[model samples]
Target: MKTNPVIETLLSHRSIRKFKDQPLTEEQIQLLVESAQAASTSSFTQSYSIIGVDDPEIKKQLRIISANNQFYVEHNGFFFVFVADQYRNQLIGRDHHEDTSVLDTTQRLIVALGDASFAAQNMAVAAESIGLGICYIGSILNDINKTSELLQLPDHVYPLFGMAVGYPDQDPEKKPRLPHDVVYHRNHYNPQPSRDALDAYDQAVRRYYETRTGGTREETWTGQIARGLGNPYRKALKPFLEKQHLGLR
Candidate 1:
């Protein structure tokens, strides 16, 4: 298959769990922030803010809050907390004597969330292209309330996920992805998947993990899904969002 450098880089993307103990230079950090800012925003609102945490004390607190139980946070050159922020827009409206409560609606919250997610992905791609590695710490949601408080976030701002970026210490093979046919629909939604197809996919995923872990892990994709979704996850998310003045509509 013919591919360019961008495609190749994306295809090789993997979550780096281990990173070299070296900090990123100021120039590199600036470039990453610039790349994130270059991402597209909803209606030009650009409702996202990034907090780069470098202080050892703050990073330690965040790692504990995340419950990620990983070394990436401690070793990563920079850990970024992406925040979905409508606060700036709300303040702008207030300055004009306009009611800003409308910004508390779920619709606006979604826009800010999308803006933050897009910015994170842009930075991730840029990092991969530059020979750096990244790992997203979604477990930060484990304690969103505490996370926000610790970050000293104001109203109209909510913590999304964090990214740990540094030089890779390990090389992992690319993991398998599901077939495109089931993922990409013609126009509308097509949700049905044949048992045989799913079984094949499950087997493929099992083999991938088994190989990756040197036979230590023999888990399947569907099994992981079952374990992940069977129980409640981050039940506090909704309440946390509401407290942040997001998704309150």
Candidate 2:
């Protein structure tokens, strides 16, 4: 199929870890936010917020909380915290003397999360189109409680993920995704995908990692899944979510 610029940009996506020592202009920041705001929202609720962090002290605090990758945070770029927020709606309900109980349910939480994710992807794509590389920081969930406290997050608001965007210092190949057949089903659900296809993907993943890391981390997708899922991760997030009045239907 013939592709357009947008499709080409999407296809060339990569998670950039290293970044050059440069700051994004205010215009770029505004454009990124505008792009994010243009994403589809659930019921037009716009149940999301973005916090751009530039202070070194705050970045240090976030770096400590994120635990794994701190490269971009330590450098100069735009670090945005995408927040899944329903707090505004809660307040709106209070002003209207309306019941805000529905906002505390799991369904509403899902909506808010989807809103935040869509906004983040829009910002990411826009940033990439402007020659900025980006990486998502999910390790912040390692200490979501502390992160909330540090950010002074109110009830009905949760930090979904952080993104670091800057000029690319390193060029990396686009990571492989699952095959179209495996991911895209026409109508009915296909629970049993071809084992051969999965095995081939595993090999492809292994080769990608090996070549990327100079053979130091030659691991298959299955191996990564096993390791990543082997231990309990963010198990405390359930209580955290309840404390934030989310995921509690």
Candidate 3:
């Protein structure tokens, strides 16, 4: 059956947690970064940067900071740590003799985060198109202080997220998502869809997990969300971000 190019590419995408022990070619890495830069930027400001972790020692250190995710340390042929960077612009402002203290504000930090996320997703799609696998490690937020020091991040540059890329060694079952109505709203905002949509999605997820992972069935989506949200591992992020000089009050 024929499919829309975008839809077909997206349907083929999945998080790959396992990868073969092989490094990517220079040509492949160049194409990945180039495609990442092609993503849209807010107001054409492009307030972001990506640090490619090439050294094994550095990648090992980052793995510890990211809660010891062995997959992050060993699997990927390329590890790109996307950064929310305003220092580059601050330098530009300074060259023009303009004050850049505003770069420390929370609002500007949001802009950098938005830019970094967009670029990261673009690179992910581009890699997937070439039969590469991608996984995002939000766990990098676990130790912001250590990450800041390891990467030698400047005042206005913060690690937003990390991406692991390589050929897939395993094809994990695709996790189910809520129906479109739950996330996509019409002209006017509506919360009703979120209310019951999650319950139905929970069943879809449980069936997937039971057949794929052979894991115990999930009770409900609400319960799963509550379990994750209530964990202390998720709560430590605010203080961590503050320590890195991000989200300045």
Evaluated with lDDT, which candidate comes out highest? 2
Error of 3 at 170 (Å): 1.0
Ranking by lDDT: 2, 1, 3
Q: What is candidate 1's lDDT per residue for 13-66, written digit by digit as tens?
A: 999988888999999999999999999999999999999999888788788877
Alpha carbon lDDT of each predicted model: 0.89, 0.90, 0.82
lDDT of 3 at 167: 86
Per-residue CA lDDT of candidate 2, range 5-38, in tens? 9998899999998999899999999999999999
**Which has the better TM-score: candidate 2, or candidate 3?**
2
Candidates 1 and 3, the one with greater TM-score:
1
Candidate 1: segments with Cα more than 4 A from true spot = none
TM-score against native, each model? 0.95, 0.97, 0.90
lDDT of 2 at 149: 83
**Candidate 1, clashing residue pairs?**
none
